[model samples]
Target: MSRHLNAGERIIESETLSGGITAEMRKLTIWTTDGFSRNLVLRTYTDSASLQHAEDSLERESTALTTLSGSAVPVPELLAFDSTATHCEYPSILMTHVPGSTVLADEGVDDRVPLLARQLVEIHAVKAEPRPREYQAMTTADTVVVPTRADAEVWAAAIDVLRGPVPTYDGRVLHRDFLPGNVLFDVSQNAAPSITGVVDWAGASWGPTDLDVAHCSTNLALLHGPQWGPRFASAYEEAGGVLSESTRTRQYWRVRDALACSEEVQSWAAPWREAGRVDLTPGVVEDRLDAYISMLMNASGQ
Candidate 1:
């Protein structure tokens, strides 16, 4: 691995990262014969199923990193990408590792919420040509289906309320899956936490900025509380990101995300159950989804 990036250097150690649903991450520590050392993240699929099912290919993510170079969005530097599996069991992208920890359910995270809001502002500020068709189907609420009796009636009504033309807005390159789990924070003793980088660009696309906003805000509500969503949205607007106060517009996105993410939340049940998070049950997720939908509707003045 070191030879691919640094000549005369060899990997001294490597560690695999867990908690990733799509791809496996490995931090490779490399040392040169002259004593220089550095760390790089080798991101690749663990199996053919993951490789094929991923939202974006390593090549696509590499292209995105290249395109985002010098942009306000904090992203890892793409060192190299190999589409063919000749060099490894699966295709991969090697990138400079951004030093930080993924903050999930941390007690000290409240102080850092504003910082995360600002980072999203920076991301939305980047200029890019519109890719309207990109991710339209995934973010569109019209296609949602209720899987069982647990979600049938409410899910059907949520879909009904969401029926309309997709709201048009100024297009920006979006971090489609932006959430606390995907953001890395550099935290130290008695120091302000700063976001080092936002990873997991697999779902990235050019689309309405509010999709990103709604996605993060909704996730914040689920992880924190109902109040966090409004707080985060307010913080985002205060940081120079334009978010419409129109309840209908807000509802459009919240509903879109609710429909799209419910499936994801349900899919996570197995993994959470395996990890012993007994609370991540179908009932819990359904309740959360229903609450989130209702929150959006009430906020939308329904």
Candidate 2:
């Protein structure tokens, strides 16, 4: 609705809907020189208070892209960036569309499960700068050092332990969100495609190699169920991955994910509450919530 937008660039057609973080992701039918031929997905964020932080994330992504430039990885090409404004009123980025049939079968992630593990191993195989840690406001180092002993808080606790020992460990390149959905399987490459692009650089950070694997493995199980769980780990081990070293780190993320799910229940709360959007049973939420809690308990050696 802002008048100061780029000239003659009225949105041909657009739709607003929930995106990855409860924010609106808009699909724009734009007027291109060749005609309205492009379908672009634009995700926006609010909280002007964190504009600077958003820009930093944008910059961090830029660095990751640059690091991944000459590799086999597939990622959306960064098109436009304006990290300084609020959603619909601030900075944004335009990316090339990544189109392909999802590898996820109706039953869930298929047995070609090892593909994910292979990619993770391959990503770490990439040589790049040390990964930066995400501390919400005051980011930390990637080298993890568990000091005197581990704490009970899980993810944050691991960071505390690692901070005392080695805040930043020079490790393999980590795709912070290297999940199956984040992965694009190439059907065009005669079995495996020549390129597999990983999207969503929001949480891309450098750290332990196994952290990436465990994040994907545990999350897949959490999202899809136990069937795909062991296969993921199986594929990971087959791909030269080490489970022992990062299991603790992986546990941290598993617990962190549960906390994330809990927060979402509160998101869109006021509107949903007024709209009677609490259709999902409370027990269902608790069941899913408990999965993460169980994972945390197991990781704590409790």
Top candidate (lDDT): 1
Q: After aligning candidate 2 to the native by TM-score, how far in Å is the CA of 264 from where it should be?
A: 5.1
Each prediction's RMSD to truth: 3.2, 7.6
Name model 1 segments beyond 4 Å from true: 53-55, 84-87, 129-133, 139-153, 266-283
* TM-score of candidate 1 against the unseen true structure: 0.86
Q: What is the lDDT of candidate 1?
A: 0.72
Top-TM-score structure, candidate number: 1
Q: Candidate 2 has what TM-score?
A: 0.64
lDDT by candidate, in order shown: 0.72, 0.54
lDDT of 1 by residue, 166-229 (tens): 7777678777778887888888888888888888777767777778888887777666555677
Candidate 2 off by > 4 Å: 1-11, 47-52, 86-88, 101-108, 129-170, 184-196, 242-282, 285-302
Clashes of each: 0, 10
lDDT of predicted model 2? 0.54
